[model samples]
Target: MIDSHAHLYYEKFDEDRDQVVLRAREAGVVRVINIGTDVATSEKSLELAKRYMGFYATVGLHPTTKVVDLLRDIALLETLAKANPDRVVGVGEIGLDYYWKDVAPAAQKESLAAQLDLARRLGLPVVYHCRDALEDLFAFLQQERIQPPGVFHCFSGGPSDAERALALGYHVSFAGNVTYPGAVNLQAALQVVPVEKLLLETDCPFLAPQPVRGKRNEPAHVGHTRDFIAKSKGIDPGELERITEATTVSLFGLS
Candidate 1:
């Protein structure tokens, strides 16, 4: 399994970073995409990628950093991507996040458009972040005809939203949230998305799965999320692994 998105470079794992990664591998996670939220994090992700064989990186400016120049940040990201084409698998952890009050909808829309353009230019799929703005996100993606294909990381939307995203050629990634007790709605949506378009992620240093809820999450916990989904869908864990692994590799061009 590939932890499609995680933030290992974050200080939360500073105490035992190496052990964290080792645990992930021991849990059967083959690769992890350490996503960057800004220029500094992007650089950190690149540095980590250079050192770890089981890790990859994606460069982009997240929506929350609204005041930053989209073109400039993306230009910098492009330079980073060009510097190491083989290591940078996708252009993302980028998109709208209105749930965070710091970013306005207009800025989020503009940033999303620019980043989508960058992904298209790089010929890479995107790893999107949508929060409290599905309709706006859908409109912009449709307007731009965004078709590079990607996944909605930690998707918190309903069945209709999942359908729209899949229709737009995106895989829907489920995170620890699906294991939450009141997340029946999200689980319902997850059921609707075909296994081929389903991906698994931990979004680590964040959304911890059941039995570890509210605690800081890490890549090793991805298996718990997968197990929950497998049980929910009445399938075996190995089948879920095969399906999610294939979906991730196809989406990110992973070997």
Candidate 2:
């Protein structure tokens, strides 16, 4: 299995980051993509990817933070990607985050557009981090003609949103949130997401799935999310795992 998305570089695992990777390997997680939310984290992600054989990284400046100099950060990301093409698989966790409201909506849109353009120019897939701004995100994608291959990480929209995303040739990734009892909308979206476009993620150390909810998440716990999604789609867990692993590998060009 592949974790598709995680932040193992986060400080949450500072004390035993190696142990976390070991646990993920023991748990049958073959690969993990440590996402970058800023320039510092992007560097850390690449370091971890180099340290671990099956680990990979994505470089981007998340829109949730105040990007003091968007152009500089974008240049930094480009430099990182160019320097480590093998380890840096994509450009992301970049998108609008209306839930935080710390950054202005206009700024978020601008950053997202620039990053999307960067991903296209880099010839890499994207890992989108959208929250409470799907409409505007879709609008920006349409207006900018940004149709790069990517995944809508931790998707929280309805079936229509999933349909639109699939129509746009973007895979929809679900995280631990999909296991929540109240995630009816996500469940509905999952039902419509064809197995070919389904991707599983942990989004750790953030949304831990049931049986371990409320705890710091890790790549090893991706199985719980996979099981939940399999049951929701009425398929065998192993089959779901196989399909998602293939989708992740193909999408990210994992070796």
Off by over 4 Å in 2: none
Where does candidate 2 clash, by residue pair? none
What is the per-residue lDDT of model 1 for residues 78-186, given as tens digits with 9 covering 90 to 100?
A: 9999998888989888888988899888887787788888899999888888889888888888877547788899998989999999888789999999999999889
lDDT of each: 0.87, 0.91
Model 2, 189-231: lDDT tens digits are 9999998899989999999998799999999999999899888
Range of the 10 consecutive residues with the lowest summed lDDT in candidate 2: 139-148
Q: For candidate 1, report its TM-score.
A: 0.97
Clash counts for all predictions: 0, 0
- The C-alpha TM-scores of every prediction are 0.97, 0.98
The candidate 1 region of ten consecutive residues with least summed lDDT is 65-74
Following a full C-alpha superposition, what root-mean-square deviation does model 1 have from the true structure? 1.1
Query: In candidate 1, which residue ranges exceed 4 Å CA deviation?
Result: none
